[model samples]
Target: MSIAVQDLEAQVLGLPPEDRARLLERLIASFEPRSKAQEAWMQLALRRQEDVRSGKAAMVPGR
Candidate 1:
């Protein structure tokens, strides 16, 4: 990795957990802003995740 990247990574690592998470999210989003279809899928995924967390859905082991 380049020195600039190493420096930036070190600086980011020194940030608080919340700041690090926020930065990570922003960095990921910067790569590709979600399209409407992607946004809908993300919403669905979040709902499904909540359902699983709430015991409304169960995980099945795959063979």
Candidate 2:
């Protein structure tokens, strides 16, 4: 189920202090992009592209 931002904020505000902190942390973590695997793959792809552009690497033709 989707929640409105205002509603989520209100609910979080009503939580006990420690609970609120934990909830906020979880929410922030959930919204963050770029998991470890994705970051690694992105780095690898960028390096490959650079290598190809600089003539340091070449693509093999597919059969």
Best candidate, TM-score-wise?
1
lDDT of 2 by residue, 1-63 (tens): 999999988987898999988887787868878789979998999999999999999989999
* Estimated TM-score for each candidate: 0.63, 0.46
In model 1, which runs have C-alpha deviations exceeding 4 angstroms? 1-7, 16-22
Q: Which residue pairs in candidate 2 have backbone atoms (N, alpha carbon, C) closer than 3 angstroms, thus clashing?
A: none
Clashes of 1: 0
Runs of candidate 2 exceeding 4 Å displacement: 1-32
Instruction: Give one digit per residue, the lDDT tens place, for model 1 in 10-51.
Output: 999999999999999999999998899999999999999999
